[model samples]
Target: MTTAPLISLTWTDHVTGRQGHLVIDRLVRGVSSGGLRMREGCTLDEVTGLARGMTMKEALHYDPRKRYIPLGGAKGGIDCDPRDPQAYGVLVRYLRAMRPYIERFWTTGEDLGLTQDIVDRAVAEAGLVSSVQAVYPLLDDEAAARRRLADAFAVEVDGIGLDELAGGCGVAESVLTALDRAGVSREGTRVAVQGFGTMGGATARFLARAGLKVVAVADVKGTIANPEGLDVEALLAARDAYGTVHRTALRAHDAELPAGAWLSADAEVLVPAAVSYAVDTANQARVTARWIVEAANMPVLPDAEDLLSARGITVLPDVVVNSATNAWWWWTLFGDIGADADEAFAHIRRSMRALVEQVLTRAERDGTSPRVAAHAVVADRLPVIAERLGWYA
Candidate 1:
């Protein structure tokens, strides 16, 4: 196999007046973009890999939308602990120094550790234009600019709801896709979700409302399991601000399992909505669910995916899981309004359903798993973009 050439990479150490890292693994003409990830042990290679994923995602969107706008995938990372107050100034400085690059191709927003306030600070220090301002800078009123930015980022297709619904919708779609492939019905399917953050909580609520028996749910505090199913409303009320459902509060109806027992619970589907790499090689054997829907990015590593596949468990890849909502958000942000909000949502639903069906169909035809089949789909599409750009004859 031939190695891909590195496209753009730079490092800048603004806090110490030294160089820190800025990597652009691939570019798609006028459409290069990605999210900023802040974690304790993030690496340049990991960031670069994520950038490559973005490239595939954006390319997939362009073909379907037929916008012909140049778009590429890119990502940025910082290895600093977000809890440390002192690191805030350094991060701001580092971000400010990268203003020129961010202005040229990247438009960042809240990610894992980053918040809206942090994004605003970075934009101010860097003097980069906001997505709304980039299009309507002449509007003098400050309040108007803020409102426009909010609208630019708001959930237009579904109206202004909690951001958690995006995650829930992705999870719901993944579940439905996997069930369809497995010849299962979603009407009364049982599900157990681990991690009760934005994604997990929303997924639980949505699934419960969709008639899925939410037999088990867990968070940082502990796990709760009830074969007869638990009340999502009561669970939501018991959940704290951080989204952790108190085990003691739910003690009346269910037994408290081990912290990670949600994985082994009796259910047809398992949704990992927490942080990344939760289902690795160590706990792969403990996964008893027939299907695993990754609500979090890269929650299951490559090896774990292989292990589960070998055991006849269908694992839906995260690329398809999160990309639909992301595409919707990005499309709305860029002001590429569809016929209407309903029309926009329908577009997203169709794209997601098609991608899922494509992966499943290819997997069945090739006698391979969906994860492996996804790579081929991505590889085939990338070259078409390259050929269009004259990178391939």
Candidate 2:
């Protein structure tokens, strides 16, 4: 990472029992946060890279000139089949092991195979312990800690604002903002969303609500499309725990297509919300969308993004687009104790839209991708932020 990494530590993975890693790229208020991702190819290096993006995301949201919430960037990952029956216990143990760091340094929510339900279970235990320790020394009683823990979970696990949905909301915010900046109306604006999981499904539904046509949505099961737009709510009902919707879900209206069909869909916008590297060299040429808003981490490779930028495609970076929920996490924890899910969503939509617009303005004026422009913004603030946040001290 170009910026000095603050903390790098590994753990015995719950699912695989192999070595996995957690890294704190930066720290705000003596703490950091990000997602806990688990899949077949996950590695420490990948976690580090994701952590770096989290740092950039924090910088984007906590811009000193704007409404900011101080939060450092962090990420964690384990390599295993999270579908295994053993995953729950393993995840719980993982969190228990991370108890001290979580209390004092980092907190991870959900990502990839790690669902919000599982996240609730994993972090709930750690938060309880941390909350207990926080007040036990001074108050010398469990009542205060118990109350604190209850409040944190009330905001975190409540039905209205699941962490993954929050992420998807953020992605939708970026897409809407980018579209408005491009002078594209939401009415009849076709969107092809690849990877119809938590983030993708949420983005599709919100876009549909905003009068955009969700023409296509693809998951691991298959891709379903309708030029007139799919019924997002019905499709959502059919989605499985992992975000896949099979023939049973879209039974009558489904236009069964091959995998990766969303990439080539004739649409004004494309959102890659599932796997990383969806827009690599192999399929970069097939992405016909005028605006590519990366809803997933590292969805577009560097060279591929370069090619698209050269071809006049506006590529919004994942950090900026996916920053909403992270900011919400910090805000709910340290800024506003009474913030509800709707308020959090509205605030993030406003904040992220403004941030995306700023990046787009600078990028368009300077003939650079949104990512490069965003990096310049973060670079200018990093030195000062480092000093203030106790980096390299």
Candidate 3:
């Protein structure tokens, strides 16, 4: 049996008849943290599961020594294709309708199908102070924290924003850590990433820079494969906001395969950084990689993961792999790190490396998957957090 969410509400848009859902899985210090995502078929159950994942993501990062503390998990999702002409209006209406929750309980930013800039613009248009204003009160100095976070977001590294690169840095570190533990050489390691959006693109860039060959990348249109390794930076430059690559940007030797071809690409590591439940029970057999590093939330289904485990393909769970982005946001806002890109990157690498090592060590000791080990880490910390601060602080 699963724990029920603290709050669940479905709001119907009066203008377009579209529906949006918000699920506050838990609240710590009277606030919950998560992101708002927009997709065509987003459901309450999906939002519920994501909200719970947020809880675990938060708890897994809890450290008494760190200045940044983890908040409870919550998530908001809308059921509408972001490309629709009416999508922007639906978003504004959703934000307007959920204003009270935004002001009091939920602290949200961008997730799938939405960008932080879009969310910020819509939030302002909807008369909200900020997308993350709900957690302002918890900060020691709200104004200073806001300024720090603003400055951090303003800083860009190698043509990409620091905010965008943080998560991918963490994801890449997890892969490298796994490879190191297994005695695999990064020089010849091949990686195939699905989705060239924020997380996937960043992961590809970092891994490529780290001496890993990004042999294949899949976007909405199809998979672009190069056995000798694709030019990651060129492909990144050709991507639109939605991450679809321009066909003209491909090299003459690049092979355009079906979008799902990324699943079976000959790579040592596979990254599913786009949609949820991408690697399900049926498609699990196509995976030939030794490591499946999840950069997106809930990309692998439970039964599929069980089968993959049986086959000895280790899955680095998303709860640990993708938690860095969320942590980076809070870390910047709470004064854990400053606005410098190098500082932020260094902090993320160290933290993620340590976290991956811990999760892998525990998994080996207990003969469990990385997901189970992550959950155990969270289980150990949640009570400590609640005991020290009280549930609502």
Candidate 4:
């Protein structure tokens, strides 16, 4: 009853003699690309599923008929911790071993623990296009290698960093998208962000500046609330690297509540930008936000999505919000786009806004949740490519 992976990949480092697992769950229209998540728990199946999401994301974002860019969904995973002393070398060797396969069928990018530096080193050592034509005859030309390296390198330089603000921007964008769908004005919209890390904090600050009152915010340490609004700058300064705001330092400004209390905060929009699977079936009942925007990947469980949808709470899926950063990276790296920081941010904003609007409109028309509507849209796009390739006949 289960389906098979569209593209399977395996790599062994020639230098370190270490083997890495890679998988592409689904190749939309025979083209595939996605982030390379390097972590101990990352599995072939998980990466493959991520790749399947990437396939849908690419299909929804990039139109081959209009843009001339044919992207499928591909993902690579190295089963090692970046903190390991030999991590860099192992990654280099992994890239060299997978160079042929990458050139032939996939493009790689940073994800999870894999940073831009690692990607740059890997691409550089692998020589963009691999010289070993036996593995990729179609990529025999040296120009292909150069192009690949150039593309990968560009993403490294232009891609979003691990800045705290990146997550906030994504959260803010998601909230904005949801409001737009409801035709609700944000002039005095109340918002609460659960997780004070880069994503949550940044979203709070941005939302505050945009006239939305950030009534509540929480971290691993505890939650803070002020029905009027919270001073984002002071709170950010009091927070630690893990996004935990020191409880002792909070006496100057507002009311401090227990950890994870933001879930019950009275707000129009609630953003869960912290850890994965934070909102599951158990806590789904406690959440009281009118709209939930996932600033983190899969913050809500599959079953919870249905629950929230039934309760009339709009849940904007993480697949699109978190992908804006990736889109910016891809455009900057492969499209030869983004000449400056401002331009790069603008590009991200434009892409995110357009995608949010498209998905929202589609969802409204179909009278379905945005996530389901997005899948439907992707389903529709797939057939066009299938027909083009004569697979639908």
Best by TM-score: 3
Cα lDDT of model 2 by residue, 1-393, tens digit: 386678888888545575567888887656676888877677887888899999888877765653334567888877666777777676677777767766667767778887766777667765544422321322323464345334544664323345556677788888888878768888999999988888898888788988999989998867899988899888887778888885776756559898889999999899999888788977889878898988889989999988887787888898888777677655555444224567767777878788888898888898777898999878876767877756622
What order do candidates take by TM-score, descending? 3, 2, 1, 4
| lDDT score, candidate 1 | 0.67
**Steric clashes per prediction:** 11, 0, 0, 12
Off by over 4 Å in 2: 13-16, 63-68, 124-164
Could you tell me every candidate's TM-score relative to the true structure? Answer: 0.82, 0.88, 0.99, 0.74
lDDT of 3 by residue, 1-393 (tens): 178999999999998999999999988998899999999999999999999999999988888888898999999999999999999999999999999999999999999999999999999999999998889998999999999999999998878899999999999999999999999999969999999999999999999999999999999999999999999999999999999999999999999999999999999999999999899999999999999999998999999999999999999999999999999999999999999999999999999999999999999999899999989988888889899877865
Tell me the tens digit of each residue's lDDT in model 4 across 1-393. Answer: 025566677666665555577776554334456766666555666666667777676666665533224356667777776667787788777777676667666666666566455576667876763322222332334455446534433442222333224435655776786787678898889988887765677778778878898888887667898887888777877776456787666545578888778887888888887656778877888888898887766678889888888888888887777766555444543443533445555556666788888888888898988888878877887677655643311
lDDT of 4 at 256: 83
lDDT of 4: 0.67
Which residue window of length 10 is worst by lDDT in model 2?
131-140
Candidate with maximal lDDT: 3
3 or 4, which is superior by TM-score? 3
lDDT of 3: 0.94
lDDT of the candidates, in the order given: 0.67, 0.76, 0.94, 0.67
- Candidate 3 stretches greater than 4 Å from native: none
Looking at model 4, report the run of 10 residues with the lowest lDDT sum.
130-139
